[model samples]
Target: MQTAQRNSLRLLQWMMVASLALPLGLFVFASAVSWVSIRETADREIEHSLDVAHEHALKVFETIDRSLSEMAEIIRDVPDADIVAREQMLHLRLKRLVTSLPQVKSAWIFDAKGHALVNSLVVPAPEIDFSDRDYFKAHVDADIGTYIGEALTPRPPYQGAPFFGVSRRRPSEDGSFAGVLQASVFPEYFESYYARIGREPGSYFALGRADGTVLARFPIIDRDIRLDRNGPIAKLVAANPMAGLITVTSPTDGIERRLGYRRLAEYPIYVGAGLETSAIRARWLSTMSQHLIFGAPATALLFALLGLALRRTRHLHFEAERRQQAEEALKHGQRLEALGRLTGGVAHDFNNLLTVIRASVDLLRRPDLAEARRLRYIDAISDTVTRAAKLTGQLLAFARRQALKPEVFDVSRSVQMLSEMISTLVGPRIEIVILGSEEPCFVNADASQFETAIINIAVNARDAMEGRGRLTMAVGMAASLPNAAPLPQHPYGYVAVSVADTGSGIPPDQLERIFEPFFTTKQAGHGTGLGLSQVFGFAKQSGGEVAVASEVGKGSIFTLYLPRTAGSGRSRQPATDAAAIDGSGTSVLVVEDNAEVGRFTTDALAELGYAAKLVGNATHALEELATGAERFDAVFTDVVMPGMSGIELAQEIRRLHPELPVVLTSGYSHVLSEHGSHGFELLQKPYSIEQLSRVLHRIARRDVGQEAASASS
Candidate 1:
C-alpha cells in the first residue's frame, strides 16, 4: 500500500510540473515569434508601398500616352486642304476644340516654312515661327504618321504654359505630308491623378516628370524642399527605366519619400508616384506595436496558468493543500482581529495617559522655574505627547475610526513635501523615489488620514525590503480597468496613490491576508502587524479602497484609490483662517440640561457683558418664548435631554418665537442631523468659553427676519 501511494504521488507531481512548464515555455516562444513577425511586417509594408507606387506611375504614363496618340490619329485622318484657307478656317475650329477639352492648352498648324498657320490662342502667330519644332520634327521622323512628343513647356515668352504636345502630319492622297497639326496639354490635367494617391493626414503623394519637374503634389510643396534633393519620383525615373523604386526628400514637408517610377517607349517622358515612407509603414507599425503590447500581459497570464498547473502536479495531496490554505486563512483572520483589539485597547489606554500628561504639563507651566530648565521640561513634554498622539493615530487607523475630512489638495505638492520625511523615516539603507503628477487630482478626504496612510504603506514597503531596498511612491489617476477586471465600485471617482517596493515579495499564501489586522510574517518583537490593516481601514473610511498585489521573489504594489472631489485642483481653504461674525445685543435665553456645562457657558457670556437668562428644559424654554411678557434675542439650548429633543423643540420655538435666534448644543448629540433639511447651526459639545462668547456675539448682531435658515446642523 505504501509503495502504491508513493508512486501515485510521484505521478501527480510530474503531471503538475509538466502542465506548468509547457505553457510557460510556449509563451516565451510565442513572444519571440511575435517580435520577429512585427519587424518583418514593417519591412513588408515598405516593400508593398514601393510596389503600389511603381504600378501607379506606370498606369499614369500609359494613360497620357494613349490620350496623346488618339489625338494624333484624329489629326492624321484629316485630308489636306489649301494652306491659306485651312489656316483661317482651322484657327476658329481649333479654338473651339481647345475650349471643349479642358486639358488641351493649344492646337496649332505649321507649314514647312516654320511659321504658325493657325493656333487655339487669340495671340497672333510669332514672326519667326518654326514648323520644324520638336513636335513637327518627331512627326517627320515617323514619316506621314502620328507621334507623341515629350513633356514641353514654354521657355520664355509663354513661361507659365507648362504642357506636353502631340503632332501629326495631314497627308495628301498621294501619301505626301501636308502641314503638321499639333496639340499641347497643360500640366493641370494630371492634377486629379496625383490627388487620388494620399488621403490620410500625414500622407502625401507627388508626381515628378522624367526631366525633374514636379508636375503635381497632393499637399503644397515648400520652398525648402526646392533646395533639397529631388523627390524619389524624379530620382527613380531619372535613368528612364521602364519601372523602378528609390527614396528621396519630399517636396512638401522635406520628409524622405519612397517612390516608384515607370517609363514607356510610347511616351517621351517618365512618370513617377511618390509616397511617404513613414506614412506607408505607419499602418503596419501600429498593428505590430499593438500586438506586442497586448502580448506582454497575455504571455504573463499564460505562464501563470502553466505555473498553477505545474504546482498542482507537484502536489499529489489535493485535499491536504486545500486544508492547508483554509487553515492559514483562518489563522490570518483571527490574528488580525486580535491585533485590532489589541491596538484599540492600547490606543485607549495611551490616550488617557496622554491626557494626564498634558494636564500635568499645563499645571507645571504655572509654577515658577529657571527659564532654561522650564524650556527643557516643556520640550520633553511636547515630544512625549506628540509621539503618543502619533501612536494613537495608528491605532485609530487600524480600528477604522480615523476622521476623513476631505478637501481639494494638490497631489504633487503633497508628495514633494513628504519626500524628505519619507527618506528620514525609511532610513539610509532604502532608496526612496517620489514621482509626482503634472496635473492636479483633488480628493475630498482628511489630509492627515491620507498622509498617514501613505506613510504607513511606505513603512510596510521598507519593512518588506528588510531595511535595504528601493521604494517608489507615485500619485496618478487610476488606469482604466482592463476588460479582465472591472473597476471596483467607489463612492467618488478614483485617484490612485501607489507604493512599490523592490524587496522580498509577499508569499502567495500570505497575499490575501496582508491587510488583515495583526497578520505578520515577521518574528515577534519585530512587527506590530497592524501597518497594512491601518492602511486598509483608513482607505475604507475615506470612501476609498486599498488593493495589494505581489509575487514571490519579485515585489509588491499597494494602491490607494481615493474619491475624487468636486472642483478639482482648486486652491484649498486655509484651515487657520477664521470666518468672522458680528453681533448686535438683544435679550437672549439660554437652555441647558447639564449644569456645569450650562453654568460654564452662562458665566462666559456674563463675562462678555451680556444679560443672559438660563433654563433647563425645552418645554419651559418654548413656554417662555410663547409668552409675550418677555422677548429674547436667541434661544440657546442643549439638544439631547430628558424633556424634549432639541431639534423638535427648536422647530416649536421657531414657530412660537418666529424671529428669535435658536442655537442648540450637545456632547454626544446628533442635534445637527439634517433630516433632509437645511439652514441651522448647532454648536458642538465641550465648547470653549471664548467660542460661546463668539456665538452669542454673532447671534445678537444678526437681524431677526423670516430668513428661514442660513446654516444647518
Candidate 2:
C-alpha cells in the first residue's frame, strides 16, 4: 500500500508539470503566429502605399513633361523681346501651368546661355543665370527628354527652403539646342500629403531620383539622403525593373525599415513606401495581450483548439493570396504579350515605310538625280508617311481616346473618295465596288476616323478573300434600307455603311469573339486583330453600332451603323479641293516657326504654280503686310507658336484685313482645342501638297467671288 501511494504521488506531480507546460507552449505559439500575421499585413499595406506613391509621382512628372513640351515648342517661335513682352496669351498659359497645379513652384524658360528669358511667376528678370544648375547641365548636353535633378537650394531672396526641378530641352528652328524649359517643385508639397500616403503611424514614404538621391521623405526625419554609391537601391534602379522590395537601415534615423519601391517607366524617379518592423511587433504584442488573460489550466484546452483554427485559417489565407497573385501575374503577362505583338507588327510596317523614305532621301542627296525620279522619290516618301499615319490613327481611334472634331459629312462621298486607297490596300487581285444611295447619307462624326473604319473593314474583307475577291462598300440612309439596325436616340436619323465580301466566312462560335481585342484568326505576324475592334469602337464612339451576318461556307457581311444628320443628294468628295479652281499667281503669306516646315510649304506652293512668301513668325508676317510692299491674297499659319497662336494671329489679320483669308494648320493645338476653328479654314498638319493647294485655291476663289459679287451689287 505504501509503495503504490508513493508511485501515485510521483505520477500526479509529473501530470501537474505537463498541465502547466501545455498553456505556456500554446501562448508562445500564439505570439509567434500573431507576429507573422502582423508582418504580412504590414507588408501588403506598404506595397499598396508604394503603388499609390508611384502613381502620384508619375502623374506629377507627366504633367511637368507635358507642360515643358508645349513650352519648348512655343519658345522656338519667338526670336525677339517685343514678341515675348507683349504676348498676354503666352504669359497667361505659362502662369496657368504654374498656378493650376498646387505642387508646381515655378515655370520658366531659360535661354541656351542659361539666362532666364521668361518666367510664369514674375516678369522676365535680367541676368538670372542657371548655368551652374544640375538640371541645366543635364539639358545642356542632351536635346531629348525631360530630366529630374537633385534638390536645389533656394536662390537668394527666395528663402532657405530647398526645391527640385524638372526640365526639358528646347531646340531651335534649325534643330540646334536653343534653351531649357523648367519647373521647380517644393518638397513640402509632397510632405503635405504624407498623412494620407503613409496612414500607419510608423509608416514611411519617400521620392528619389534615378541617381539614388532621395528628394523627399516622410517623418521629415531625413531631408538629405545621398545613397551609397553602389547600394541596393542604386543597383535596382540601374537594372530598370519597375518594382521591388528592400530592407535597409535608414540613413536619416538608425531605425530599420522594410520598404517597397516603384519606378516610373518614362521618368528617372522612384517612390518608396515602408513601415518599421517594430511597428508590426508592437501590434503583434497588443493582439497577444487580449488572449493572455485566461487561467493557465482552463486556457490549455481553448489554446489547443485556437491554435489549430489559427493555423488552418493562415494556410487558407496564404493560399488565397497566392492564387490572387498568380492571377494578377498571368494577366500582366498576357497584356505584355499582346503589347509586344502589337509593337512588333507596327514596327515591321513602320520599318518598311521608313526604309522607302530613307532610300528616297538618300537618292535625293545625289547631285545628278533625274527630275522625274526626284519627284517620284518625294511622292513615295509622302505616300509612305500617309500610310504610316493611317495605321497609327486606326490604333488611336480603337483606343477611343483621340479627340474627335466632329463635322457633318456625307458617308457616300467619303466612301467614294476612299475607293482608290481601298484598292491599293486590298491589292490588284481584289476588286472593290462601291454601291451608293442616290440620296445623301450624312453623319456628324470625325471624318478621318470614319474613313479609317472603312479602310479597316475593307482590309479585313480582303484578307478573308485571300486578296482575290469582290469587296462591295455600300452606304445609305436608314429609311432607304429595307432592313437596318435600330438607331440610337439624339441623332435625327442613322446611316448604314456595309462592307460585304465574297470569301470564306467566319465560324458561328468565333463570330462573337472576333471583336475582342488581339483575337486574331490569322497566323502570328500576319494581323494585330484590331481591325474589327477598331470598327466597333469607332461606330460606338460616333453614336453608332456594328453588326454582322456570317455563314461558315458563305461570305460574311459587316455593317457599321452611324448616327445621321439632316441631308439630301449625294455630294462630291473634296479630294482635289475644288477641281475647277487652281492657285495660279495667287500670293500667299506663309507664317511658320520651323525652318524645314516653312521651306517645304514654300517649295510645295511654288511647285503648284502659286506665289509664296515665307516669314518666321506672326510679328514678321504682320510687319511684312504692314509695309504694303506686296499684295497677299491669303495667309497660312501654324496654330500654336510662341508670341501668338495662329488663331490669335488670324484674329489680328481679320481685325486689320478681314477680306484676306487666314488659314490655320496644326498637328495638335491647344488653341484649336479650346477656341475651335473660329470661322477660319483649318488644314491639319502633315497635309499633302495636293491638300494644301486645294485649300488655298478654294479660299482664294471664294474671296474673289465675294469681292466680285459685292462690286456688282
lDDT minimum window of 10 residues, candidate 2: 479-488
Clashing pairs in model 2, backbone N/Cα/C closer than 3 A: none
Candidate 1 deviant stretches above 4 angstroms: 1-344, 351-432, 438-440, 459-469, 479-493, 503-534, 550-555, 565-569, 577-713
Candidate 2 lDDT over 1-713, as tens digits, reads: 99999999998898788777867788889888888888888888988888788788888888878888788667666764743575466666788778768788888777778887777766645466788998888877667587888888878756646889888877667766677788998888887676666768788988887677888888885447788758755775556467777776775678888888887887777788998978877888778887786646456688899999999999999999999999999999988987886787677767878999999999999999899999999999888888776666556556664446678888888888899989998999988889998876778887867887888888889888998889988887664323443532543567989999998999988998887666789987687777787887787667677889988767999988877776443454554333323567788999999999999999888877788999989999999889873488889999878897788889998898877888889876645554568989998767877778877877874557767899999
Counting only residues 3 or more apart in sequence or on different chains, how many pairs clash (N, Cα, C under 3 Å) in candidate 1?
18
Top candidate by TM-score: 2
Residues 108-145, candidate 1: write the lDDT tens digits: 76665556756767545555566546777765544644
Report the error of model 1 at residue 682, Å: 6.9
Please provide TM-scores, in order, for all candidate models, with all chains considered together. Answer: 0.39, 0.44
